[model samples]
Target: MRIQVSRQLLDRQLVDVDGRLVGKVDDVEFALDADGVPYLRTLLTGPGALGLRVGGRIGRMLVLTAERFVTDRPMVPLRIPYGLVDRVDSAVWLRIRAEQLPTSPVEEWLRRHLIGRIPGAGRAGG
Candidate 1:
């Protein structure tokens, strides 16, 4: 589909069919074919990939912050293969629900150690 890369694509949140948030578009992956032609391979997200794309001090700080959350020194980006994408409009839609995919370690940690500890944290705010 013909889409305005910046407006219709970038920075938009990706959600699964069931309405679970996957992530935002941090970067797009590309693949080269036999003719040396490149095509969109996947959508990359998470603080690590986004930090590098953002660049400079701010980006480095973001990466470092994310790294501190996990035992690993470097945080890894989440990859959503292009084939799994169902459509693109105001936001990207995925064919499957987010629970099917691996959960972000940072998110799990926060929910368990931080958010879960607070009263009414389980409830969503309007």
Candidate 2:
């Protein structure tokens, strides 16, 4: 299907099959086919991609803040193959569930070190 990347894909919210918020379409990857045709390879999401897209001082701050939680120097974005997309409407729906996708490194780090440490973090709130 033909789609206007900037209008229909970029900045669109990404959802899993079960309607869970995966992330936004922070950026996209393109690859060339054997026939020299260009095609969308993956949908990149997470702070890293967003920071890069944003660019400049504020962007650097974003990346640095997220990096503090992890030992890794550069965080990697969550990459969802374009083929995994089930449909595109107000959001891009994935054929698989969120659990099927890899968790963002920064998010994982934060959850383990920060969020997980808060009082009553293990309990459900009313």
Candidate 3:
């Protein structure tokens, strides 16, 4: 199916088959086939990709903040291969469930250090 990458893909919410939010389509990756045809490779989602796309002092701050949570100086975005995509409409739907995918490091850090520590954090709010 033909799709306008910028309009249909970028910034679109990514959802797993079980209806859990994975993340947004922060960036896209492309690869060339043996026939020299370019094709979508992966969808990148995470603070690092979003920060780089924003491209400014605010963007740099975002990258820095996320980086501090991990021992790795440079953080990599969560990459969802194009093959995993099941469909696209209001959101990009993946064939697998969210639990099958790797968790974002920045998200893990925030959940552990901040959000998870809050009272009632373990409970779903009304």
Query: Could you say which candidate leads in lDDT?
Result: 3
Name the best candidate (by TM-score).
3
lDDT of 1 by residue, 12-123 (tens): 8999999888999988878997999987887888998889989999999988888877886678888888889899977899999999887887898898899899999979
- Each candidate's lDDT (Cα)? 0.87, 0.91, 0.93
User: Model 1 Cα displacement at 24 (Å)?
Assistant: 0.5
Clashes of 1: 0
Candidate 3 residue lDDT tens string, 1-126: 888999999999999999999999999999999999999999999988999999999999999988988888788899999999999998999999998988888778899999999999999876
In model 1, which regions exceed 4 Å deviation? Answer: 123-126
Better of 2 and 3 by lDDT: 3
Q: Cα lDDT for residue 53, model 3?
A: 98
- Candidate 2 structure quality by residue, lDDT tens digits, 7-89: 99999999999998999999999999999999999999988899999999999899888887767778888889999999999
Off by over 4 Å in 3: none
Q: Tell me the TM-score of each prediction against the true structure.
A: 0.88, 0.88, 0.91
Q: What's model 2's lDDT at 126?
A: 64
Off by over 4 Å in 2: 118-126
Query: How does candidate 2 fare on TM-score?
Result: 0.88
